[model samples]
Target chain A: MLTKRIIPCLDVKEGRTVKGVNFENIRDAGDPVELGSFYAQQGADELVFLDITATNEKRKTLRELVSRVARHINIPFTVGGGISSVEDVVALLQNGADKISVNTSAFKSPQLINELAKEFGSQCVVLAIDTRQEADGNWYVYLNGGRVKTEADCFRWAKEGVDRGAGEILLTSMNHDGTKKGFAVDITLQLASLSVPVIASGGGGTMEHFTDVFRQGKADAALAASIFHYKEIGIPALKQYLQQQGIVVRWESNENFIC
Target chain B: MNIVIIKYNAGNVQSVLYALERMGIAATVTDDHEKIRSADKVIFPGVGEASTAMQYLRERKLDQVLKDLHRPVLGICLGMQLMCAYSEENNTACIGIFEEKVRHFSAAHADVGQPAGEEPLKVPQIGWNNIFHLKTPLFRGVHENSYIYLVHSYYAALGEHTIATAHYGLDFSAALHKENFYGVQFHPEKSAAAGAQVIRNFIELVPAI
Candidate 1:
């Protein structure tokens, strides 16, 4: 049985974690490697490091961070943000990143998805779609960190991405992102119909929300940032809660063994 | 022990190297025939299409080098599939270490008894899944039904070489063992602790005489 995945995403800038990660025991909250290993220790199935660095040296910084994370963390991790070309992906993968997520670049040039899927296997390419529901009640794809909206319908675009050989879809809803209400179950449910696995992101405020996404929305995995970084929800407790809710998750009996 | 990872045109060998480093084992990633043939244990790791990889291996005659190894050889993911006799992927012929055929996952949902309105088993079968019926020394300390991470669309059909099994719509070979060759469908490097344990077990295995 394939267990539902729980992922904690971290935003990185200049090789340092940018978000406020409120962990008391952590010595350096700014270190992406430390935070990533911390999450892996806490039973995070996987980690995603979105390199938000917008400078000329972003690639070098991200590569170094990726190498450090791979050296320390035992589980799989994906590196995204500012990944535009095959060279960028090769650099990251060579540095030990498992997968690379492409959003704006992929939307800008949909062939980028095909080229990546060809160069690396589809398993290594993750198509992240940032979408928002408009007044027309139709979800539209958003680009450039959710600021610019495109004419691409979320559902149709997702299918096109999948057809282009994207092995996984990371669907993040802009409207519900920070609202703390719940995940965008409606669009997520529709996107789950695609052949590839769908990872629902944004708007995960509670453990029940995770259950809803996996159960009702049929998401194979759910990704969140702040709720986990702030210590509001511990991964062990969340896994336990999901287990009680009859969701199958990978449970590590000896959590400290990895340490 | 002199450990060498046979490198052709595959991805994710870096993670395998890091995993070995965690166990304090320094492994050499090389396609050089001398290094691989001289190493006490050889690891064949891959993540790519079958025909293309096989073509690369054949072009360099690494296929013959791999087939000629007398010591223990371990294959991961695409490496495992390529160890089989044949693969439906691009209708490619693979090394004959394991006498099974690798078949692609079909979207047919009725066979799995998936109720209508339920999502069919996703291709690539990403995330963690348990392996059971462990038989070989490869899985010595690993617990049965221990979840291991996997991401692939094709699987080797269960046969005499199967030492472990996992289900995703049907029972398939999770791990296979022959005279001196071992192949696992999962990425032991990225599977966390239990996966690490599998790697440890492989490292500790005495090379077959």
Candidate 2:
């Protein structure tokens, strides 16, 4: 059986990953290569590098950064940010990224998912959703890094993404992000109806938070940024905790730990 | 010595690379014929849809190179599927090393009410399945019915190359071995200790040049 994965996401800007509160007022974490290598060593199943900057001219920089990270990290890496066309996805894949995430572009043209999946297999395409809970309890999916709201319903878009050929769905809860309260279990469970694997992002404060998403949210993977970046919950310890909970994680002997 | 991982737009190469790193063996991923042909060992790991994967291999003329490899070659998941004669996945023709056709597990077995003769199993057979009935050095010290991680909907029925077997909707080929070529449906990289031991065994089996 495929065990649920634990992934750590890094927000990259101008070649460096930025981690901050509420996706604003960011602080430099470290070099992307170093952080990626650290997470790979710590037992992260996969790493996602989201280029936070919204621009058209920075694709080359993102590509260079991806190549650098690929040189050092051995695990699967997904790159997103400012991806508009199939060319963007190809460029990222050519540079060493295992998958490309499309958010705003997919919303602009839902057919993009189908097209990309047809051209480069569904497993290579990941649909990233930035969702916020409306006051009325309806979750509205946003784009452009949660800056703009789309009329497309969150659940509808998720199913559409899978229908269009997204191998995985990365749903980020804007409401619980950086708050440490917990993941949006209801939303996660709602999205779980689709066959594609779901990766829950945002709102992770502790190791218990991860366990909660796996147990309660029913997510295939739980991704947290600051917690892993700040050395708060190293991946090995987290795996131990999950294993104790009967999650059945693949444990590796940490021979590199020179202690 | 570097292990050459064929990069024909297949998924799970990263997983194989990480698995090798876990065993402290460094490898280089490449699609170039010269690089792959000269390497100590060649790994063709795959995931995702098969038709397009075969298309990519054909486009790069890698199918011929893969068939001609004299050194040890290891294929995992979709990689194993591609090594077969043909796949029902999009009805794609493959490298044809193994004379077997890949078929989707039908729900007929799962819907049945009989205790032994049950209904058809579900599609996209996901999660941890067990692999048993091993042959040769691949299973080396691996225990029978050892639980391994799997995430595929289609499976290769028993054929001339089947090295091991597993049951989901029914008994299916779990691993394949043919001379210098080998294939395992489970993701060795993600299979924990059993998976790592398999990888280590593959590394150890690479014939010295």
Candidate 3:
């Protein structure tokens, strides 16, 4: 059976982890490689490193960080933030990134999705959609780190992205972000109706939120940042809890054997 | 052992190289016939569309080169799919090393009914899942129901050559072995500890030839 994925997201800036991680015994919390390997050791199904750096050397820094992370961590990881061209994706993949996420560039020129899907298979292309529900009770797509809003409907744009050859959708609800209340079940459920797998992001406060997203929202995966970074919820315990709830997750007992 | 990873137009092979390096083994990535034929072990790693990859191999004559090699050759993901006789993806003919046909998961799921209220199986399964019924030296130390990562929309049908199986909507070949050739549908390179063990087992296998 294909199990629901639990992912730990890291925000990287200038080749270092941006958010303060609370993992004990970690020599350098700023080191993405060490932190990524630590998360893999904790049985994180996958990792997503979002490069939040805005500089001329951002690409070089990310490439170095990606290769360093790949050399240490064995599980698959995705790299995102400011990835617009095929060359950028090529550099990252060549350095060992399993997948790449695109947002603003993809929205500005939707053809970029087709080009990436053509060059590399669709499986490696992840469409990251940032959206927010407005006064009209409709979700609108937002871009540039949720600062700019577009007239495009979230559901329609998601469907269009899928049709254009995005294999997965990372839907982050701006409304629910940092609220720690719960996932945006309504919009997530709608996006999950599409043929592609939907990764529900933002508003994950507790393990029950994960259960609700998987059971009710029908999300194929759930991604959270602070909850994991601050050690508020350990992945092993969360997996056990979800397992007890009858949700199938990839839980292995051989923690000591992880290489 | 001199290991060579057969490189083509397929997706990145750097992860595979990095995985082997973790095992303290350095491998060369090349397409030269002599290098692949002369190596003690050869790994064919791929991550791309079937027909296009097969076309590249055919054009480069790597298909024939691969078939003629007697050394232990292991294929991963699309590399495994291309070892089959035919693929439903883009209606392409494969290398015919394995008699089974590569099939799209959706077409295979049609006969199997989904449990009530369950979400339809997503295409291109993109996460960790367990592999069971291990029967090959490739999985010698790996336990039954060991989880491995996978990402694909198509799968190779279970057949006589199947050494292991996994279930998505139905049971399909997780690993296949025949004589000197071996193939696995999952990306062992990206599958963490258990995956590293599988790669180690393959490296330690005694070539039947």
Number of the top-ranking candidate, with lDDT as the measure: 3
* Deviation in Å, model 1, residue A258 alpha carbon: 8.7
Cα-lDDT of candidate 3 = 0.88
Please give the range of 10 consecutive residues that has the lowest summed lDDT in model 2 chain A.
A250-259
Residue pairs with colliding backbones in model 3 are none
* Alpha carbon deviation, residue A98, candidate 3 (Å): 0.5
Best by DockQ: 3
Tens digits of per-residue lDDT, candidate 1, B1-209, equal 99999888875799999999988999998999999999989999989999999999999999989999998999999999999999989999998888999998773334457766756788889999999999888887788898899999999999999999999988999999998899999999999888888898888954465
Q: Report the lDDT tens digits of candidate 2 across residue range B1-209.
A: 67999887766465577567656799998999999889888889887788878888888899999999888898898999899888888888999988877887654344434366422333455445668788878777787766676767778888878888988657778889888888988777765556777788888854543
| Top-TM-score structure, candidate number | 3
CA deviation > 4 Å runs, candidate 1: A20-29, A55-61, A254-259, B107-117
Q: What tens digits encode model 1's per-residue C-alpha lDDT throughout A87-135?
A: 9988888898999999888988999999999989999999998898999
Model 3: per-residue lDDT, tens digit, B34-127? 9999999999999999899999999999999999989999999999999999999999999999999999999888878887876688898888
Candidate 1: deviation at residue B93, Å?
A: 0.6
Q: Could you tell me the lDDT of residue B65 within candidate 1? A: 94
Which stretches of candidate 3 lie above 4 Å from their native place?
A19-29, A54-61, A254-259, B206-208
Residue B30 shift from truth in candidate 1, angstroms: 0.9
TM-score of chain B of 2: 0.92
